[model samples]
Target chain A: MSYSILVVDDSPVIRKMMKRSLSLSKLELGTVYEACNGQEALVVLRREWIDVVLADIHMPVMGGTELIEAMSKDPELSKIPVVVVSAERNAQAIAHLKTLGICAHLTKPFTPEQVLHAVDDVLEQVAQRSVA
Target chain B: MSQVLLAGPLGEVTKSVLSEAAFLFCDELSEGAAPLEARLVEATITFEGATPGRITLRLPWHVACEAAANLLGAEPGDDDVEANAHAAVGELLNMISGSALERWFGSGSQWSLGLPSVSEREGRLPSSAPRGELVALAIDDARIELEASLGSVT
Candidate 1:
């Protein structure tokens, strides 16, 4: 089945790159949504049927931390997996992301294989969770 | 830590990030051979936590176009690449700063990377950032400079 995805980041170039990487890869994809910040992402998450989210941690208005926190608090949104794609390298920052319940973290300048691998891993987890 | 300590990691980080993330190739520039074009743009980002500091990146206008085009798989002069040049440079600054911070400090060091701000200006480094240590590189056949100014380490 194709998976609908949401990509949240302030940089237009990054957003475009992420989309290109996904579309060119072997993953089965559906509609891809874009948001400028965590706040905008929240709006999209609430309205759309998203399978996963690839987000950046720092942005104007709201950030990935805030978005993840909001999702964890909500029952429905919490079920969808998140893969953080960011420039964050601090261990503490990454640990904080783990505690917030993200499935994976890929540092920026990531290769398409890395992105596809992370997405595939998360999607597999979702499938297994459904089977159980 | 001081800029002297950061100098090594800065050089390596810029090269790897440009090559891996931006799809741009770069090499450390030889002294006294720096040639910057008439147009340039700077992207600056600030980080806080164990070490608070600012990292600034300067690129020739044409180099920015090359970076954007590479990132987007478009031609350098393509309209989309031209428009995305600023954002591409800003994102590159973010990646370099994030990697450099971890390599300079410990990986477990607590810190928050800031968003990069980009602006177009004419020629060379700006009047600000006198205390910032600079790293020069030859990228896309143009001079690219990076500077880092660190605050008191906590």
Candidate 2:
């Protein structure tokens, strides 16, 4: 089975990096979608069957915090796991994200292995849920 | 006592942040580009509140090309790629600075980052000055520098 992933970040570099990293990893995933920010991501979410969401916290329009809050409220969208990727090192900011029920927090300047591990952990959980 | 004193911790943090960003944005290990060059692109972001200092990134042409290509997931084919990479470099620097400041000054401190200014070559360093201190790091032989004109001792 293939899983669809949505990558949202204001920086095209980060978006491209995420895409390339995932592709190079050769993860058994389906077509990857991209968005500039959380607002754009929401629009994509409505139309696509996204299994996972990788987002950055500090974005121009509708940041990761707002996106997570919005997703948590929506019954259909909330089910999709949301991972927060950021360079912001404020412990409080991270705590706030955790409070919002973000699946995982990956700090900026992350290694490919770190990113892959996060994806694997989330996907594995999703797989187990289906099996159960 | 002196502005250079702050460079010790600040420089370490800045380098860490940049290194992390480099790893994330560039496929350094896989890509043939071994030494990722990052120049300080002429851009500054101000920090307000209790602890305040400006963060700047200066990038030269070649460094900009490699950085842009890495961020865009495509080789620097034309001017468009270079432009996009320049923008990406600014944002990456902003994020790194913001995160580093937050680390030094708890979360409650409200700070604002100014619009990043891009230049083809290095511009004048901040005027106030920080005891003539300049910090540079070697990333696969590419030299990355971080200089600050820290006003008051923190």
Candidate 3:
């Protein structure tokens, strides 16, 4: 079945590139949504029925950390998985992200295949969680 | 460390990112090669922490367009590529800065990377700028410059 997804980042170029890369994924993809930052992403998550979220940290207004934190606080939002795509390389920062409940992390300069793999991996975990 | 010493890591990170992210390969320009004399797009990013510094990238407009197109897997003439050439350069700098910082300090260290800013620049590209140039590259039909100016790190 096809799945809807949301992409959150402050850079339009990155947002555009991620959208293009998502299309390259062999998954049965549905409508892909976009947001400029966490504040905007929250609004979309509240209104849309997105199956997964691919987000970037280090954004203005709000960042991926706060977005994930907000989602974790909400019972319904927390169920949907999040995959972080970012340029962050700090060990502590990445570890901090793990504590926030992100399903997967993909560093910058990733290939479209890499993005697909991340999406697939997270989706698989969600499927397993539902099965058990 | 001085700019001359730090440029090595900066160049290494730049080549790696450009090759992977933009599907472009590059090499360090030799000492004798003619300097890059052309209109260019300059992108800069800052790292704040114990050692605050800035990284800048400068490349020709065509190269920027090509990079944007390649990153999106689109043609250079596409509307999206034309509109985002500056932004493409900026993001490229951002990626380069993140890795460069990691290499300079330990990956486990703490540092905050700022958003990249892009602008237009024109001049002859030397091996190093007054602030500091990590390296110069020959990519396709253009020359690209990577620079970093940082605080004292002994």
Instruction: Indicate which candidate wins on TM-score.
Output: 1
Tens digit per residue, CA lDDT, model 1, B75-154: 87788998999999999999998899888887877888888999998875433445678888886457788888899422
In candidate 3, stretches whose alpha carbon ends up further than 4 angstroms from where it belongs are B127-129, B152-154
Residue A97, candidate 2: alpha-carbon lDDT? 84
Clashing pairs in 1: none
RMSD of each: 2.0, 6.4, 2.2
| Model 1, position A67: C-alpha lDDT score | 94
lDDT of 3 by residue, B56-138 (tens): 88888889998899877789888888788888888888888888888989888899888888898677776443566557788
Cα lDDT of model 3 by residue, A1-132, tens digit: 788999998888888888888888888899999998999999999999999999999788999989999999999899899999999998888898899899889999778788889998988887788899
Clashing pairs in 2: A109-B20, B39-B58, B40-B57, B40-B58, B40-B59, B41-B57, B41-B58, B41-B59
TM-score of chain B of each: 0.91, 0.66, 0.91
Cα displacement (angstroms), candidate 1, residue B90, comes to 0.4
Which CAPRI tier for candidate 1? high
lDDT (Cα, tens digit) per residue for candidate 1, span A1-132: 899999999999999988988987677899999999999999999999999999999999999999999999999899889999999987888899999999999999888788888988998899998899
Against the true two-chain complex, what DockQ does each candidate achieve?
Answer: 0.90, 0.28, 0.79
Clashing pairs in 3: B7-B134
